[model samples]
Target: MAGLISKVFKAKWLLLGIALVLLLVWILRPFLDVFVYGIFVYYITRPIKQWLSRYIKNEGILVSVSLLMLALPLIILIAYTLLVGMSQLMAVVNSYGLTAALPSGPLTNMTTSFSQLHSNLTSGNFTLESVTDITRQDWYKTISGYSGNLPLLQAIAFSTGSTIVDIAFKLFIIFLVGFYMLKEDAHMQRWFAGTFPKLMDEHNRLLPRYASAVDADLQKLFFGNLLSIVFFAIIAAVVFEGLSIFAPVPSLQIPSPILLGILCGVSALIPIVGMWLVAGPLFLYLLISSLIAGTLFTHFGYFLFMVLAIFVFVLTIPSFVIQPFMARGQVHSGLLMFAYVLGPLVFGISGLFLGAIVLVLVTHYFGIVVPEMAAEGQESHDFDL
Candidate 1:
């Protein structure tokens, strides 16, 4: 009768816990992005928080100093770099007369010109050289003329303003939540441990060990990935800059070396495909340009060769050589790769971290927690016998 009553009491608490969890999830659904980002920020700044804690006893002061000294500056630097890279990329697009082709006026004119060119080609009267000349003169002029319109500028300004506001609001919420989380990290952990039922004594005892394993894996994944990004970005920029300076064909130079490098770095974060995201588009652009101009086939060939070389040296080599060393046995390479790839697809950008966390927790429960519980049960059975 006592055992039956205890089981019933536990069931009642379990149902209450489930209901509370559902309520909390519903309430937090709107701010999920902010909370997810806050967790990421907390993980990234955890080491700083620990280090600062040694010198400062007050958690509030330590978190504030860490945020100001580390997080704020990092955010500002990233924002500045992005703005500069975008400006440089826009300048390159403008220089190439690409943006001019985007407006309706220029697109309509290009369509008319293309129809005439197609008709001439079908008649066999227009040679490739004549077609090239027409493209150089008519296409260039039409694209260049479209750039002076006022509506395009106004549209761009409005879009930029709205994007900035959205980004700022998100950042504010992330930092706010992250600051509090960091300040109360220990208390949160204690509360979480206490929430588990007494029936889960073994699990409660093993919780710290499980948490430590998760933290180690997360640290390795985050820091190793960060290093990989920086390494690829710098290598890509240097390789492209070298090609611009030394390549035999000046016309085949990478248009925006810095911007391309930044993009390559961002692409490097994507698992499996990696830097190919940037290199593939560049290859296509050069191929099309060479075919259209007809005179730069050799230049395009050399440019393509250089791009492949950069991919091999900067991207492929490091994935094998540097990443293993950085990972330090904290997490399986295949699993981390899967988490990086599938996380964003399922959960948006925050999925990257969340997926890894879920994987780690599941692995820990099965590998450590379950086995330990079974061994304890066996011991208890032996003692009863």
Candidate 2:
């Protein structure tokens, strides 16, 4: 009885110590994220660091050179893409006369048909003048609502600034971690191997295999996705220009090649619907413009179908076909369906990385524990019999 009591008291103290440590970690969680994100960045750039190190024969010089080399290309590409998108947006706004309330040009064709159909059915005159008044009133209301959101806009700006600072700090941490990880790569491996006395040989043997698996899977998913986005953007641009569907719509005057390409590329990351995310507002623009021209009733149905089809193809196809295959291939930690779903829910956007690590550790721990439990249960049953 005394021995059992002593063991229980020891366990209680151990649990208390662990709880204190966890509490400290939780409090420091936000700062830790900056370090954690840096680790992921290190993982992504490790190969480049190695290759550069070989050429320079100095780890420090190699890391510095590789970072500069990577940064220049990334900055140039992002700047060019953003400039192209913004210039196209400004051109579209300018071409529409900025504040002109009436729908004009090829867009007038749909309005003309709608007025005739409405007059035929209602036995009342449906004039373009009345339609125009209603539309201008609605636009005024929308503008007023946006004007009321000035305070919200300021809050958003402040939040954005803080977020940028956090990201910058994290990126710096990532570079530091990457440099040291590259410099002392052998020391890290040796430390890991020496820590596990019982399974030192097996653990050392499998460490490289595990690391390689993670590296291969993550690189394939990330790089393949980057390529896919660029490809899809180019395709969207070509399709928009060739179709000229937006040519008739005043809401979209941007050169179809540049504007549509960028929208398709960036929005493609949104889980379910990619380019279709923008299609709804665009369709509404056409609808409102036609209404003001007194011809919305006639060609509305046809216009609706065309917009729907474009959105469905742009948004749905990639998500259903591409995403699942990549996810299954990369996340091979034998996580069950529940963990797979809930992992992201608990982890935020960073959940994909953290969740995979947690899942792998949990699985390994259980793999050891469950068999021992089973074996003990069987032995007890035999003794009882």
Give TM-scores for every candidate, taking all chains together and pairing residue i with residue i. Answer: 0.56, 0.45
Candidate 2 stretches with Cα past 4 Å from truth are: 1-24, 71-154, 157-168, 202-212, 223-385
TM-score top scorer: 1
Residue 112, model 2: Cα distance from true site in angstroms: 37
Per-residue lDDT of candidate 1, residues 231-268 (tens digit)? 66667777777877776755566767767876776576
- Which one wins on lDDT? 1
Q: Residue-pair clashes per candidate, as listed?
A: 0, 4
* Predictions in order: lDDT: 0.65, 0.52
Q: Candidate 2 residues 204-241, lDDT tens each?
A: 34444555555555444333443345445655665555
Q: lDDT score of model 2?
A: 0.52
Specify the poorest-scoring 10-residue window by lDDT in model 1.
Answer: 103-112
Residue 106 local lDDT, model 2: 18
